[model samples]
Target: MAADHVDHHEHHPHGLAHQFEDMAQQKESVLLGMWSFLITEVLFFSGYFLTYLVYRTQYPVAFAEGSHELDITMGAFNTVVLILSSLTMAMAVHKSHEGSKNGTLGYLIATFILGGVFLCVKYVEYSAKFEHGLVPGLAWHPHGEHSPQLALFFSLYFGMTGMHALHMIIGAGLLIWLLVKTAKGTYTAEYNAPIEVFGLYWHFVDIVWIFLFPLLYLLGRH
Candidate 1:
């Protein structure tokens, strides 16, 4: 009976993994694995950015026009939204680390809500683009000499922003899971590895948008 009780308490107190003997080791391992995954993601996003640079250099006039079609106000607003979400996510991790279950849950909820707002803004932007016939291979009708180049620009535009939106969607879902777990008191000061890992992921997603905004929406505004 004592052994079973001890095992139950150990899991709660430390949240150890079968492969690790202690919480510290598990946290380090989990962070290493997450950082490795994030490094791969950075490379993946870099490929898209490189593509953008190549095509923009190849067709600066067309790129400028294409960038002008984007609503700078909306893009800037979403940028602020995402930045705020990252802040809240950081706070959530801090609260979780402090072992304040309600604080963690509140901040997670705030992060989740901010993420939803970003998606909603994205939806509006995409709808506006579709209405303007900005999409390629479906409704694009260029009014200038750079029609083909504009098509290429919009193609990369949709692809990159679309990929980023997908990441936000996934991140929001993960926040929901974290919110539930935090509410259940699954995370404590000693075992908040998952919260910390998810926080890093959230911050990464927002950083991608920070770059995307300037490239896609602010490039030709001047």
Candidate 2:
């Protein structure tokens, strides 16, 4: 009986490590780590954006023409969807902080569904592009005004959106794991660092799309 009690106490201690003096310190540590990682990610995406600016400047007409080929309606719709997902994700974190397990799970499911929807829309766009032979290096044959630079434009388009989509897939996977843990009550009002960290990541992904939508879809809309 003493051994079982000792194990229970060990498993259900306060939400701070021995090295950390309090919950605040532990939470601060987690937040700092996440922010630092996000900063690096920002720099990485900035490199891509810098490359985009240089190329767009080089092929202004071609880039403008290529941007018009993208489905503005679909891109706009995706922006709305991602914004909603970010809201649900924030709600998930808040609910976890409030000790509402069911609320957290529900919000997380909503976020996961929205993420999947974004990927599906991206698939539709990509499939149409592929059917039209717009993808570069794979039987690409442009028959439009931007024929010469269309390949370069498409290359960048694929590179940027593909990287973003990969992040969404990973985020969805993380939500699945969070869902399981929430179902099992691994996180509560006292300890919701995992979901909070994931929220940071999700918000980062959404912010990236916010930039992508305007640059890729709205360049020639006006």
Candidate 3:
């Protein structure tokens, strides 16, 4: 009787939720939910991307001039940093599958740090734009021949990159929560769905930046 009771509590506490019949069912439900949320995010970003395409096509010269103002070196560095963070995030998921608490903590820490670094670099870039009076509305100063179109390029720049940065900030917050739970041994080989699901989110953020880098920074460098 004691053995049966212990098994019941064990599986209920960590392995399965009340709505789920078993561990696999719980994981599948959670993953499906995460994917559903991500699909909406894709739709959200797609609108911005489509708008950018339309405007860039209409104002090619102005957009190219705006792209020239961006620092490709810094943009490339952040791209590499996000790529490395994605690798670390994948490793963290792997460690969770192995039920290695310390391994998961270490990799999560690395990912958090990389995210911070990316945000810091973006801040520097934003500050430079502000100093140069490139920001739209507040202080409009355009060095390009097409002032109106040049402002449009910067408007799109901040709108897209700012949203991406906000996502990174939110991801960083999630990582901190994961780190705390991981340290407490909340996840194990049999029940690591949270970590795995978060991996999908982190990967999506990285992929968005991959697209942003080329579209905003390398659009007309050639």
The candidate scoring highest on TM-score is 3
Greater lDDT among 1 and 2 belongs to 2
Collision count for each candidate, in order: 0, 0, 0
Per-residue lDDT tens digits of candidate 3, residues 103-181? 9999999999999999999999999999999999977776756999899999999999999999999999999999999
Q: What order do you get sorting by lDDT, best first?
A: 3, 2, 1
Query: TM-score rank, highest first?
Result: 3, 1, 2
Winner by lDDT: 3
TM-score of each: 0.93, 0.91, 0.94
The segments of candidate 1 whose C-alpha lies over 4 angstroms from its true place after superposition are: 1-13
RMSD of each: 4.7, 5.6, 4.4
Off by over 4 Å in 2: 1-15
Write one digit per residue (lDDT tens) for candidate 1, span 110-182: 9999999999999999999889988998888775788899999999999999999999999988888888888
Residue 103 lDDT (model 2): 98
